[model samples]
Target: MNEQSISQNKIENWREDRLPNLSGKCFVITGGNSGIGFEAAQMLGRRGADLILACRSTQKAASARMMLEATSTGTINLVTLDLADRSSICRASDGVRAITQRIDGLINNAGIMQTPKCQTADGFELQFGTNHLGHFLWTSMLLDRVEAAGGRVVQVSSIAHRLGRIHFGDLMGEKKYSSTKAYAQSKLANLMFAFELDRRLAKAQSPAIAIACHPGYSNTNLQSSGPTGLLNMIYKPLNALIAQPSALGAVPTVLAAAGLEAQRGAYYGPTGFFDMRGPVSLSHIAPHALDLERSARLWAESEKLLGISFLSQD
Candidate 1:
């Protein structure tokens, strides 16, 4: 069957596809110290993939490494990556390059959620800067390495993207700010970036591919940490009552990163009950996310904002 047909038709049974032995593969995952990122890392490591857990916290990353080493039969290294800072991103990129020349998978999974109006270290809106712009720069820096390995770039977006609009005039939310809207826009950017990157890779005839996935409504610290006031209060109870386990939520991410049936530019996530939680499968892509014009505009704006030209010729 064709790749798209295989991925779509096997939705109910794809979970049974065992990961192949990856003794020599390398994967770099941002925010791998906890939540779905960590869960995905464990699954990959157990299958013998060398992992570079890019996290902001040395302590947490070290602890996670220890936990992974106990059960994972693969090399688990740590690198520092703070998505909110440009200098930090550059340094982290250098650190990753120092470790390996090729990456089998680069999981752009680190992100912030709804938060009070604030800016990143680079002075852009926190949500947009950290979630979208940060990953944009990081991926550009490492795209060549990924291409060398014929790898995949997995963008971990969110269901909130369904309610997002790219606020080009007010991308930073300086004119009017709503934490929820800002968060949604950032996630939409994530999914859009994946689609745009995949298109660019195809045009360049590069072997690398980009895929997107969401964790559904899995319980994670993001709810308590990012939101404030009313949203935080509401999420606390709702997280326990309705959220799925992080392990289950990480399934789609794992599939995107390592599943052989995952098609280029495809999106995967939960497939039950409003896509909040259930078995892993192909998921819907919002119409706005597929807007070729707007996605290209967002890509251009991203480059302009980040002061970097990315994938211009290749």
Candidate 2:
């Protein structure tokens, strides 16, 4: 077989026979109450991985927990986390620290999609602040715990990133904004963060690894939520026809978080037509995401904007 074919075969085989026994492992999943995050949590929970669902809603978290408890072989816990709020992120991190000393995996899965223009509590573009900066801060706070367990940090990006470019001159879209472009930029930031974090971890000789994944065109509330007008009108019908189930969409994320075959700095997603849905496999990383100079600048800018030195010791 050719190299690509060989890799595909290995991934297929690994999915079937080499799934890890996740007993004793603990994972923290943002937005674990619903959609792709919940589905990914289910996959890990089935393998005996203890999970903490960090969500914005207590009611949703409780409902998800009740459902998860019926099927999961491992502990199911909850913590309130509002990614739009920096104080909430800090509190959630503290809540996680109280629950577990070491997290085997930290899944940065919660995000807002193409929403109308707005700003976060921290005065950043809502999508960029919540999707990228929020996770940025949370991960920084929890890095020591993850490193303690030689864990993996899985960042959930998106195919929208393919068209994204960092607007360094107007990072927050303060002058003018398009929701689509803003969402794309945030997702791009997510992927670039994973790569940059992996490089930093290796340089520091840290045992923890960083990986990225996308869910392709998953049928989830994400399409219904946040988006309005034309975007909503398009996605609703398009999703019904072409989108995969959230369970299938979440496979790449589950792999990145728990699969032994997943590699540091790698990206994973469905390998089907237009990458909408199919078997889990390595996905394309946009050239902009691979731009080392831009990625490093983003890292520094993130620290400056957040007013914190991220991983300074490392």
Candidate 3:
């Protein structure tokens, strides 16, 4: 197929025939209630994977469970998770471990976009805390389980990451803050973490693989949490024109989660039009995003700050 046609096909069409067999596999997806996340969860569930829908609210998680059960032929479970709260992340990790001894895949899809600057319950910047740090700590706690199952970790990133530059000195956004910058930094961190994790896994000879993907501009609720009023009015029109459907935007993530050709630390996204729209393909990796030094620093800082250590475990 031609590149343009392939991109269009992947976006508009459902290719369930290409999905790998997942009858006995188990997966945990954060933010599985809405948009791309909801679609990804539904797709995975339909393909026969045992699914856990992790959400910040029990009600939303339950609702997501109902939706998945109604639409899928596989088992579905609901679990409470609030990424902005370290205690909540710890509790949820424990819950997951107690329920499942093995986790075949983990999709870190939960995130908040450009909201008004705020601090998490742990006093970290909200976007960075939830989008990057929460997932970091949660994944660390689950590393052994994932390794046991020979699983994969999918980090949902964004194209905006291209504009991001992590400021180690101002990780908390205390000196200066803008919603877009905060969101971009968090997304960039996702890519960094994914690559860094793959490096670690390689060194340790672990079976787990780490990958990253971005949803091409998709029509989702991501903007609803952003600056409201006039800014919302301006973005509404642009979103309508540029955003693909949530199902389409989720292709790269699903591919990363299940595609046989996916390699450790590979980054995937839409392959057309500045990566805002296109067929699923191996996308470009930013030089800074792949910096091992920065990634190691971030990993160590995250471990110290969260008081969780993945490397220390056997």
Better of 1 and 3 by TM-score: 1
Candidate 2 structure quality by residue, lDDT tens digits, 1-314: 11233354335412523468999999999999999999988889888989999999999999999989877999998999999999999999999999999999999999999999999997999999999999999999999999999999999999999988899999999988999999999999999999899889988999999989899999999889989999899997899899999988888898889988877778888878887888778876667788888989999999999999976533
Q: In order, what lDDT does every prediction score?
A: 0.90, 0.89, 0.83
Residue-level lDDT tens digits of model 1 in 1-314: 12244454555535624678878999999999999999999999888899999999999999999999987888898999999999999999999999999999999999889999999999999999999999999999999999999999999999999999999999999999999999999999999999999988999899999989998999988998899899999998898899999988888888889987788888889988888998778886788888889999999999999989998742
- How should the candidates be ordered by lDDT, best one leading? 1, 2, 3
Judge candidate 2 against the unseen true structure and give its global Cα lDDT, from 0 to 1: 0.89
> Could you give the candidate ranking by TM-score, starting with the highest?
1, 2, 3
Clashing pairs in 1: none
Best by TM-score: 1
RMSD per candidate (Å) reads 2.0, 2.8, 4.3
Which of candidates 1 and 3 reaches a greater lDDT? 1
How far is 37's C-alpha from truth in model 3 (Å)? 1.2
Better-scoring candidate (TM-score), 1 or 2 = 1
lDDT by residue (tens digit), candidate 3, 170-264: 99899999888998999999888888888788888899888888897988888776666776776789888888889888888888787666656
Give the Å shift of residue 64 in candidate 1. Answer: 0.6
Segments in model 2 whose C-alpha atoms lie over 4 Å from true places: 1-17
